[model samples]
Target: MYRILIVDDEPMIRKGLQKLVEQSELPIESLRTAENGVVALQRIKEERPDFVFTDIRMPKMDGLELCQHVAEMDADIQVVVISGYGDFEYAQKCVSYGVKEYLLKPVSVKGFKGVLEKLIRTKSKVSSESFIAVTLLEQWASRMEQAVWMLQDAELDLVLDEIQEELKTKHFKLNRVVDMLAEINTLLEQRLNARDVYVMQRDFDLAGAENEEAVWACFTAAIHGYLEELKAKRKGKLKDPVEEAKLYIESHLAEEVSLEEVADHIGLNPSYFSQLFKQSTQETFVQYRTRRRMEKAKKLLQQPQWRITDISGEVGYADHPHFTKTFKKYEGCLPSEYRQQMGIRA
Candidate 1:
């Protein structure tokens, strides 16, 4: 017998949500609604609902603020944020405030029901240790996905070790570990390009591993082999115009590199080269060059001997102010601030 609250500005949306919850098979004893966070906060204080489904934007005090307030008042109340595609990033921020789930706009009946069911199941179980284990496992899964995308072997190894340690510390069941491995396979499959047959074969091998140690060995080998394959493919394709263009960019990072210059150097039309570069590298020539320049700048920043202006010039930026601005936008901090934060003394 759990209480629930639905908060939204639109009357129709609020009513629709209420009807959906009513139709749900969850053991909700009572359900309530509020037009905005201000009103919702009052209802929450009075009713103390076990769960709240909220929309991100409203007239008075948006969903994020509401979530923050609710967190302070009641840490146990589960929050499900409803957001549109445009609000997706804002919705991700809600997770830190203990949002249990996010539902996009025009929420499907199935999605709604699934979220409600998970919440109901979790509420019925009162084990704090179980909750913490699930949280840690989910965090580890996210880190693993990031590591795979960045092609970071060391990071992937660290994350794998962390996952294994988490399982050992929590003493998770064998079935749970297998489920986590299945999830890892699924994530790797999503990140790996479809055309990578060798990596896909390795993925299959990893999935077929019979034991924990086998799974670990197979996964490590598979990922390492995949990265090696990517490197080999890049090297093998040196005759490719795109690869030549990339080489030209890398060699001319300290110069004012241009698309036309690289295209001409590789004996291709500028327009065609632009398309091929994007198709092969998944980034525009300008974007790729800028990224390379930023990477160089970061490496140079590590050396205390190099002045910020010198680093900017070395990265092909004549204007130090522009370089600083670009670096801040890319790395989320000023050059001096980043240097200080990274412990590189002047």
Candidate 2:
């Protein structure tokens, strides 16, 4: 369906023209009517109509003046003028403005038919690519909310499926694109859930340049809240050994973290502590500690003052190469690359 703009000062004339355009065989699905040339220019820029029709003697601006301005603005549009007179001199001036067709009113049925017939043959072919771009925009909007939901559910495969379903009307090749984004979101989620690192970054962004203290304060509040929620859910309280062992590991995240040390801290056997931690967090104690440390490593990388080796040591990894490999295991990209992205955005 081609876009058509009606530029006439008279309300009745504009409405009649719009209705006629929409009723035409060429499928004028997006027809808009503007009261004057000023309004017509605004509509032209916004909707970018392929075809325009205007009366000759509108108040504040006339048809020939509008034609010249439209050419100066975007010469691609097709302009047809409607005049209440059969004046040759006015037509001569309009020709210089690139006015394709001039009609003498009252607009006979035969005249509108000719104008639309020509538009179907010329304007439709010119706007096909733009129409496809618009359809793709429509598809993205249609998928955005649902895609976000699928990601939050940890359903990465479901996200791609939803994108394919959403673009069924447009038949867009969105499956691979959405799949890649889902993978990124999964990594981001892992980091977010690990010691609340992503939440800290989000807080920093929201708190602004002068509010570093405020960001930290918010993070502290969220941590207290998460702890309180755990206390409230007595029925699903974490495995027995985790009650003390996990707390020990969190405080000692910058050291050579050991399950045996954590078990000794909590007065539990090391093997029992390991199994209990997995039952509580759905991850082995070592994997959980590594993930949490990598999350901190990413946050440390955000600061300009920290070196990668220093951050790696600070996050409890005794071996720098080992830290790099594990960070890559969870974050897809290397720590340095992630830091580069943070700096670029900053």
Candidate 3:
């Protein structure tokens, strides 16, 4: 069990840190909080937490002094500094006192979680190969997150190329590459609220990739395509009725969704909504819905646990035969056949 301390002048910051720590899956024995370094130092002496997350500036006994004191008292205690951009250089000086990581002000959840995961990996003494893999995964996840947010296509391509080069150097097996992709997806989902934004589907095949280079090329292409989709979605005009309607359709793919229902959901007339939807998406509402349903059905088919009948119902088909016909129309194969083709048990 790991004991932890959160020190900051702001009450809200302390509360936020406490909540994040409590919610984390890591094994935490106790969490202590303090408004300033003076209180934090006193609490540290009394409680002796294994880790300290502290702000650089405080009313009394700032973080630097507290770090020095903690270092003098016990070298085992790990310190993670939280500082504003202006104080970054000052925080860097705390490295000599053994500050483990530096988090900028207004910390992002991804960055916070990444730092904690890194610390946990360090304490557990993970194997060098595994450690390197984990570190690269986190770095790629972070860069991908930023690229998506900023809509930086060039940066995304650069990062993907860098990852490809590194994968070649490491000579990761196909299974290991697949596992890494899955882990990256998990991280992206956590950071991007992807569940609400888009449906993640395993619709690509990589079994033909026999070498590390081939595997990474296929993987990178898939990731690049997904990122481009996200970028396009983000580029859609803010508060665009067409985008909102698409979101409604995505969220209600399992339901008997109609143009009128979506129009009403977004406060638009049915005829007008139909026109705008077609104009914006370059497809009729029915066309878009069918494509989305087929895409979702394909995703569900990848899960071997879901039967064909269940998948039909999951994608809004009441009649199994109708689902099969529609899936074949869109995919040139039945759902089960598609699954089998992907080497997934049907």
Candidate with the greatest TM-score versus the true structure: 2
Better of 2 and 3 by lDDT: 3
Model 1, position 112: C-alpha lDDT score:
93
The digit string of per-residue lDDT tens for model 1 on 1-346 reads 8889999999999998988898887787899999999999888655567789999999879999999987775335789999999999989998889897999999888889999988987866743445334455556656755665566767877887776676677564333355566566665555565435435324333323334665555455554444444544645744766778888899888899889899778765455466557757999899999999999888888889999989999999998899999999899998898899879875
- Candidate 2: where is the Cα deviation over 4 Å? 86-88, 125-346
lDDT by residue (1-346, candidate 3, tens digit) is: 7779999999999888887786677889888999888898778655566679999999878999899888776334678999999999999989888787999988777778788877777755522554245777888888877786666767877887786677557654344465566677667556656546665442345543444555565565555545545644666734777888889999998899989999888765465466557756899899999999998998888888889999899899999999999999999987888988989877
Q: Which stretches of candidate 3 lie over 4 Å from their true place?
A: 126-346
Across 1-346, the per-residue lDDT of candidate 2 in tens digits comes to 6678989999888877866765566666588888888888777655556678888878887777888887775335788888776654675688887787877777766679788888778754554533234444334333432333233322323443453444344432222223223333334334435534223121112212122233233332332222233333433555555656667777889898678888677654354345446656999888888888888888888998888888888998879899889888889988888888887332
* TM-score of predicted structure 2: 0.38
Q: What C-alpha lDDT does candidate 1 achieve relative to the native structure?
A: 0.75
Return the lDDT, model 3, position 278: 72
